[model samples]
Target: MGCILGRHDSFVYPTWHSDPLSWSSPLDSRRGPLPLSPSPQRGEGERHTRRRAPSPEGRGGQGVRTTRARRDGFTRKVLAWYARAGRDLPWRRTRDPYRVLVSEFMLQQTQVSRVQEYYPRFLARFPDLDALASARPRAVREAWDGLGYYARASNLHALARVVSRDSDGTLPAEPEELIKLPGIGPYTAGAVASFAYEKPVPAVDTNVARVLRRVFFGKRETRNGKREVWQLAAVLVPRNGKRAWKFNQAIMELGALICVARKPKCPGCPVRPVCRTGQSPVS
Candidate 1:
């Protein structure tokens, strides 16, 4: 696929699909106590599959087996690479949700180096959700000067109020809940969930979208490509929740540093072995 990247209206996928009540209703309504059947023992292969089922994606879903394997391999390679090569970012050093949220907002249309200088100052002024919520919108906008996306800053200020009043000054840990906040959409929700709360959700940005298109789908183009790109990203998150942060960061770092839109350094990429595009330099 020739990497078709564009902004689209963000859609949130429901987290819980199966209702336990629906499954238990009829069985529980029986007058007499129902005899419970012993659970069948799975064969060795089945056991192995069950054990390894949680790919970078949460639980294995239909048509996701191959996607999970590729993502797992890619995640491991990228995280390993990140451990040695990842940049010393300010947000990486903190576990605070507010800081992570700020960095993510700044990073929407701005570069990391540029965000770095402003991040500390911004945080220094509006150190917490309460601080941001209480500050004037103009002050926040003024502080966000040079970062062109005025809407993001505006939304961030609005979100602070929402979180402060509605959420009781705590940002929700779930991606679904985060998306309900002002200025937070699919990508930002996923990024905050994975990066801040250690939830295994995929945050696919332009760089991530390009890296995925090139590495997995090769050069074949498809309709609704961006949605497919996000689906691929969601499946690749590591099952081990603790590694979700590292995994998400590694991919973003790879896209930012190695998988440059122009002149990608494929030869030096750790996941090059699995990359279908091979190690050829970008034309």
Candidate 2:
């Protein structure tokens, strides 16, 4: 065990022949030392990373392509993809605020498949804000029993009361105004406005964030950069009447179906032409 080595001032010494005073090994023995490689410095191989592209947060919510032309081009391709390949979920078939609100809450933590099981019955029971606001808390909870996250139902009930009593029994058309309702966060408010009222605003959740990162930032970031993702989504949303709503929905749908967290389907991706990691996965 005498072949141990020592490091000092970036220099290495083998205890076998090195001066005992110059270097000492905790397990110094007469067996002789072997050569070793230096450890990698912090971010030493970062240059070899496939995609070191700058995020929108780094460039004031514009990412690499700041021009309106590139942004619009990306938006158009995504919308086209959605038009041809988007899923035909029940939620997409309506513009009713009440129905959209019910769908959004049902979808918050539950999957689309499971939400389908109860959405129809729930909506049938509480057809409007007046109906929901007037219903008992126990009834609402019962409708949401198998759905889990009972708080979403509770909040929805509370929101119904607020809208019915304070705001004419109607959901607000503005995203900001919608946010004041119970259980209506940024995502829900934006979703309600865009999907129901057709407002041109960004409504990002985890899935939307993944698509934005893969398309613009060339990576994935759910936390720590979520606000940045939302800002970027808003910037990228098209202003062509219904185009913004479609664009926001398109990006989220793309993330869920194609640009998934693992094994993204680059071949069928309409925006893959401009994707960094898609172009050079091992760059």
Candidate 3:
């Protein structure tokens, strides 16, 4: 598929409905219990029926209204899948902004499997923003040695210093504030804002955008496809910030596992009802 940028073994590919959560992470019980997640309504396999969805008619008041219903239905299906089948990655278990930041940086065009091994070790060495910020550049780079993108490491370190200095050693929750930091572009900034702060902003990474392309437009985007994808992403996010965080996670996880780039499991996909392409084979 045209939208298939990269697919690594870091994410779980659920083959069975009853499969247990199977993403790896190092133990760090000292971080305390994670915050309770809002429960999404559970969908029981093929028992769920198809529903009417929004059309691709662009930019009108009535069109926007119809789209809202479609997005809500889409959100429910994806979140139910998330609740039932989402990967249990280490970074997902914590709400700490620093941990989220570190994970997001490592995950940029990188595989999840490689990142799971490095995340805790990196955290053990530099437990908080203060620790990362205060460390020497070489030491930080050394810690990030295997992650490949040395520039991300450098920028992450730089961001740590800036955020550590500017905001009482805590990363900012606002996308606007986050973008000013080194290496924190729109995607990273939206990620932090949504994943860390639970803001209802679009975190349109490759995975999320890929899902949107197939579900709404029914094929891989071309030319201005990527740009249009981001705009749609911003529009699709739920207005309720309460659901926003889970919404972002659900879509991304859906893309990563089920609605994947190549050989997508359209038959088992949760959003099949609303997906225009999922109506037929996802090829």
- Per-model TM-score, in order, reads 0.77, 0.74, 0.75
Candidate 3: Cα lDDT at 101: 90
Instruction: Give the per-residue lDDT of model 3 (tens digit) for 1-283.
Output: 2222322212211111121122112111112221122112233234432121223355332122226677678878998888888778888887789999998888876777888889999999999999998999899989999878587777778777776776789887766556556766556767788888887766766688778878877654444455456556666777677588888888888887788878898999999999878998955
Worst 10 residues of 3 by lDDT: 22-31
Model 3, CA-based lDDT: 0.67
User: Which residue pairs of candidate 2 clash?
Assistant: 1-29, 2-28, 2-29, 2-30, 3-32, 3-33
Best by TM-score: 1
Q: Look at candidate 3 and give me any clashing residue pairs.
A: 10-113
Instruction: List pairs with backbone clashes in candidate 1.
Output: 1-218, 1-219, 1-220, 56-236, 56-237, 56-238, 57-237
What C-alpha lDDT, on a 0 to 100 scale, does residue 206 get in candidate 2?
Answer: 65
What are the C-alpha RMSDs, in order, of all predicted structures? 12.6, 21.0, 14.0
For model 1, how does the per-residue alpha-carbon lDDT over 1-283 read when each residue is reduced to its tens digit? 2222222123323221122111111111012222222112223133121121133232223222245466668877988899999888789888789999998888766666678889999999999999999999789999999877677787788778878887789998865456556666557777788778887667766677878877876666664455456666666767667787888778877877888777778778898988866545566
Put down candidate 2 lDDT per residue, 1-283, tens digits, no spaces. 1111110111111111222123221211112221121112223233321111122444543333445566677888898899998778788899999998998888875667787889899989988889999999999999899987676777788888877887788788766556555666557767788899998766766677666777776654443354445556656766554887788778878777777667777887798886756775522
Candidate 2 achieves a global lDDT of: 0.65
Regions more than 4 Å wrong, model 2: 1-65, 220-224
Off by more than 4 A, model 1: 1-70, 279-281
